[model samples]
Target: MLNSNMLRKLDMQDLMVFVAVYEQSSVTEVSEALCVSQSTVSYCLKKLRTSFENELFVNTRSGMLPTSKATAMYPHILSILKIINTCHSGIPAFDPTQKEITFNVCAPEYFELLILPKLVKRFIGSRFPVIINITKFHRDIPADELMEGRFDLVICFGPNFHRGVKGLRSQVLLEDELVCVVDKNFTLAEEAFSLETFVACQHVFPTPWTSDTNMIDGWLARQGYNRQIVARANSYVAALNMIAGTDFILTLPRRIQALTCDENTFSHRRPPAGLPNFTLDMMWSEKPSQDSANSWFREQIIKVCAEDGLL
Candidate 1:
């Protein structure tokens, strides 16, 4: 059963309302988020339900839960809105100083700890009214998510992470090597930092992502050596806390140690020779290459990294 008349009455505002309501799960919240009155949101929802001839949402004790039809339609509607927004953004030029813009970025905790502060400072100094939303990187394909408008940019450890993903433009932002962080009082049997001492020490590993194995473990495996990792932490901060007054050593990026560690509380030692260096990369979908706003944003990131001597 099709309702051509009702469908013809639907508009982009109605679609926006549907998405807002679905995400917020409250009509009042949707109204506040969309800067519309409650009556307007209700009218839009009513129109959408009529157009689709479905009870898209049902009132529940918990909240306004989406019906099966709404669940199925959510992604499609979101994609449509993204496409429309892209079309509308195809301007000749972008001026960050004059426009209010929001950039959604996906990155690991490393970026948050080392780069985000300086990046925000750059924006503030330049007087750009920009909003940044950061999300955790889950080792997903940046190209697919960027194409779907999930994120405007992605910051990852190495360029190889996106090797097989097509239509992605990436740039190396910075390079860092592994370093061992331990309590200042920690000492080695010998003066020189040796692999034997490193492996002998009880280590605290930082697991920022879901992967059980990391570059450190892989490198150790290749050399037929494994460290005695006694604890696994979800973040570098947590790992640092775990090794604060203990004998546990944490092996992490050198920049992280430089930025986060206190000279009095913790000291950094060079990891065993030949540990591989890693590069941080910024990636975005190639489809938006012509988007001046995105282009400008990328330039800003690179500029900030360079100014900080990280590029």
Candidate 2:
């Protein structure tokens, strides 16, 4: 149902007109905002309606109410406008005080739970409102998609880097070691726990969000060992909660344990030998990585993480 002729009929200016009308809810307002005549705004709106074969807006007591179809199109239109603005010829001047920004990032739930709260708290009274959308980390996403600006940033373990990573920019954010967390009431509280004890005890494992791959499981498999997985949870919080008043123990990043678990309720110890420390990295496509806005946000993230001793 798609053809070049039909595509030619759809104009970027008309999409802009539709976005303005949707936001301002009046043709006169759109005209004044764009420094165009009322008639021109109406003409653009008419073209948009025809191209989409829908009455995009309807007049109601509340002003111009977008129809269901127009409402669905609203976000996509705004996204296109943002892409255009970002891809402008020169280095785009970023005025944080004047423009609000939504940053798209991806990370595992473990990292999200540990980092996002602190990161968001730092921006509470910032001049610009920064909205962060954190999606699950997908290690398999193609390099071309990232280069095409599909995601503004990604944070995950350094080992997660793939062939596509060669084309992206990355920086080490933090180095974290694995730690074993057990309820304070654990019977082994006074004893030195070894690798054999760790594998024998009931283990609580939190599954990865993006893939079926479980790092704990994979590591055990590589060592020709397996933990007694008494419980499996989709999130680190749930896994941590399940350890209380039980024989189960959790093995996870030390940072998460320090941030989420109460010291009095839980006892922490360094992981048994053979477990290696992991480095978390901040990755972004080269094209937008150097942009002023992206650079500013990256700095903000770095600052917060450092304050928490996560760096």
The global C-alpha lDDT for each of the candidates, from Candidate 1 onward, is: 0.85, 0.79
Model 1 residue runs over 4 Å out of place are: 1-91, 159-163, 189-192
TM-score of 2: 0.65
Best by lDDT: 1
lDDT by residue (80-175, candidate 2, tens digit) is: 888888678646667767767888887778668877887887777664688899888765644665688777887777566333457788888888
Which residue pairs show backbone clashes in model 1? none
lDDT of 1 by residue, 1-311 (tens): 54387788888999999998789899889988989999999899889998898999998877789999999999999998998887898456788888789999998898888888888888898898999899887756566679877789988878464445777778889988888888888855433358877788899998876565678888889999998889998899899999988888899898888888989999878888887899898888888767788899888888888888887
- Off-target runs (Cα >4 Å) in candidate 2 are 1-93, 139-145, 160-164, 190-192
